[model samples]
Target: MKRIPYMLLLASLLLNIYSAAVWGFACYAHSGVAERSTYYRQFTAGSDPRTFSVGAFTVTLLSLIVFIAAVRKLRGWYIAVAIVQALFALLYVWQLS
Candidate 1:
């Protein structure tokens, strides 16, 4: 159906936003642990996971807005966006753990 692409795009948009939110929370939740552990501090030195998550969330949100506006023209690209969304979801989970 002609609506498939639109639906896929919508799904992608939601997935990205959801993943971004999860990462945002993980960022805050992990910050204390990262601060308390010498290993974590050294590993994450010069790079705060919380800040990184916020940046990722912002970028994903902006990308979602752009893709939503151009969904019709971007047809087949929806699959790629979906794939990226999946990867982001996985990354968010990984960050939490």
Candidate 2:
């Protein structure tokens, strides 16, 4: 029961990392246009990358808030996760731009 928050936070972090990676691959990879479009379409189910990025950011923010509110004892760990999440969010924005 108590592990749920931790799991959610971990999932959030992984999702954010994945979103960044997909964005990077789509934007920077030296693949053919058809291949890149196919990859992006498959990964995002036909949605825009920016929309997917926004959804990932929203999930990360909600999960972090829940984790922090539900687990008060792991101050250091939560703080570190928050910082890493922030960095990921920044990276996402930079890549999108």
TM-score versus the correct structure, for each prediction = 0.40, 0.73
Which residue ranges in model 2 land beyond 4 Å of their true spot?
30-39, 92-97
Q: In model 1, where is the ten-residue run with the lowest total lDDT?
A: 35-44
lDDT of each: 0.54, 0.75
Give residue 70's lDDT in candidate 2 (0 to 100): 91
28 Cα displacement, candidate 2 (Å): 2.3
Q: Which candidate has the highest TM-score of all?
A: 2
Q: In candidate 1, residue 31 scores what lDDT?
A: 68
CA error at residue 59 for candidate 2, angstroms: 0.4
Give the alpha carbon lDDT tens digit for every residue of 11-68 in model 2.
9898887766775697687467666666776777796666776777778778877887
Lowest lDDT block of 10, candidate 2: 30-39
Top-lDDT structure, candidate number? 2
Instruction: Provide the clashing-pair count of each candidate structure.
Output: 0, 0
Predicted candidate 1 versus true structure: per-residue lDDT over 1-97, tens digit per residue: 5565456556656645654564455456566654434333343444465554455555555555555565655457665774675567456546645
Model 2, global lDDT: 0.75
Measured with C-alpha atoms, the lDDT of residue 69 in candidate 1 is 65
Which stretches of model 1 miss by more than 4 angstroms?
1-45, 86-97
